[model samples]
Target chain A: MIRRGGRRGGVVAAGLLTGALLGLGFPAPARADPEADRIGFRSYFQQRFPDVPAEAWIDGMYAIDEGARQQWQEIEDFPPYEFTVEEGQALFQDPFGDGRSYGDCFPDAGRGIRQRYPRFDSETGEVETLEVAINGCRARHGEPALSYDSKEMLALTAWIAYASRGRPMAVEVPDDARALAAYEEGKRFYYTKRGRLDMACVDCHGRYAGAFIRGDHLSASLGHPTHFPVYRLKLGGMVSLHKRFHGCIRDVGAEPFDEQSREFRRLEYFLTYMSNGLEANGPAVRK
Target chain B: MRDVVTSALVLAACLALPVARAADDSRTPAVEGVLAAVESLRAQAVTAGHEWLGTRSLLDEARAAAASGDAARALELAEQARRDCELALEQARREEEAWQGRVLR
Candidate 1:
């Protein structure tokens, strides 16, 4: 269910002109249908890169770039994230002071559940990301919440992601008004220009996906959330999806929201939903 | 008469120097006011979730400049920061509707 009217043509023309004048980039007039949005979003990328298979989007930039794909295939031979995944597995199984572990709070002992994250918790009436859930679990059990950037949190997410590899992304935008509003807000955040650079997420990932920006290929937004807790060669460490969001926001000259912040959680919710059928292949390597 | 004229000019110049310095010192309060304006706008931007990077830093730098008695520099930085905040607020408002256009169909 979409909340806004689908006015077309003139709105698009005016939007383009305004965007050009503002240097913020153009957008289609608003549509509120979540399923339609997902389809349109996916179709845009699919049409743009016909040769790439739908499932390959999990590879991100590598899915479209042949040379980079070859290099990435080689990197996969000896994935740098191996140790982190092991560490995460240990952390996952380690019990809290009450002798109950992180796995106790999640379904299936927290195995193979990464794809269902950034869920809309109706009770809280807010987007509850896996990170938030993890922290909440800690709070409920009388344990201190781990910082989003803490090694233990990163490791735990990495292991969970590893466990969920190959499962398709399954984020849902419930029919409730608050849920829809949250989704809409996330969509707006993706397109809206913020920061000193005056660039929106759409400007780079939508308008210029597959284009080289300073020798780095911009990945399509379609499968952005399929992979997370990526080990970046540049950072020589693992970073969760929200951490990546924070960095991208900062890169655009905006003051970033905190990790697992409501803004970021909403963003993750919208972004992950866009990749509804893409397989989760996290704890992946990136340049 | 020429010597008298030269001495008179020198004395006048000496007296006027302090007056000029006093006038310049008076600008400190004006710069502080600009800094305050920048801070207010920055808070608004932050509230709107549109605060730009470097705005806070610019405000800090302006305060530092004011503390160091560089009224001109302080004014310049404060004005720049204020402009940044204003632009951010404008962006936030513009995006309210413009974001719809950017959505994928």
Candidate 2:
């Protein structure tokens, strides 16, 4: 269950989105004020759920502990993190389907504007959104493929999300029957109960979106993904979508999906599509 | 889908109901756990008290969860019951040794 705090506080935020999109109407968050940076968002969340582990809420968007390396703390390295960022930058720089980079496609790879995902693609005849397009770029360009659920891909994806920071998520399914079908399919996935607890993703996040779960406040999933690649407290660094999905399942004692399993991808498609109008703030942190 | 949230919670409660029953029956899982932990400590006898305390807290939390209307939440809390007791047993052993050594000194 992703919460909606810490600039779309992962599951906490995800929960809110889940509830709202499912037609479970809870109050959407008030519009973010000008000072609505990750820190402010996090502070507001902490006030609401003080019991959540303090470490769980630390923002991971900034460069990891350069000072630690400056000293001698023997910090764990994230060369892969840098590599993933490079990959994302490349995609942003050159998603050239017709010899045109994304810079040429939609200026700035559509930076600071995450409000355009889950859109219907008339040409593709599918609801290909941000991730789908990125993967398509990989396929058409003969780039090494990245799984939708892979951390390698997600880190890059998070950077794309980062590029779109401050932009509202503006996903809109076409009113066509097929698009409606996809939205309904996503809705079905969200409401279905799975896992050992017989819990669905909605159990904690939806029902208790603003309530306490152990030491943490349950975040609504409404605006999830606003800040991702968020530093997971227990994980000790930024994590990807699939990792968060696995975490939710584990907490419910459910069987987690294979790294790129269809069930997981379908769920991702559904969830991300639903969060159509929130911003993307990646490489953040949460409890 | 207002039902999505509550319905899911209801289902979770159902999944966890049996565990609450298990938690209540001391002769069942909880006691068995405490016995296993105490038995382990009797040999080392080093951290018995701590283990006992840990188990106590775990059991308390488990009992609290089991007592909740949401059975799934209870069972989820229950699973930790055994471990918490085990930790307390360890802590007890450490405390006992400290006390004894001080008296001797």
Per DockQ, the best of the predicted structures is 1
lDDT of 2 at B28: 52
Q: Quote the lDDT for A218 in model 1.
A: 98
Q: Which CAPRI category fits model 2?
A: incorrect
Give the TM-score (vs. native) of candidate 2: 0.47
Residue A170 in candidate 1 has what lDDT?
A: 91
How would you encode candidate 2's per-residue C-alpha lDDT over A62-167 as one tens digit per residue? 2123342333222224423445566667756654445655454355665764456556676755666556666676666566666765655666666676677666
CA displacement after TM-score superposition, residue A13 of candidate 2 (Å): 54
Which lDDT tens digits does candidate 1 get at residues A1-287?
Answer: 13233456667878888878668655655446789989888888878888887788888899888898899889989999999899989888888889998878888867889999989999999999888889999998889989999998998899999999889899988889899999988888999899989999989998899999998899988888988989999999898888899999999999999888888888888888899999999989999
Give the range of the ten consecutive residues with the poorest summed lDDT in model 1 chain B.
B19-28
Model 2: per-residue Cα lDDT at residue A64? 27
Runs of candidate 2 exceeding 4 Å displacement:
A1-87, A94-107, A110-113, A122-126, A149-152, A258-262, B1-105
lDDT of 2 by residue, B57-81 (tens): 4445545554443445545555565
Name the Cα RMSD for model 1.
Answer: 9.9
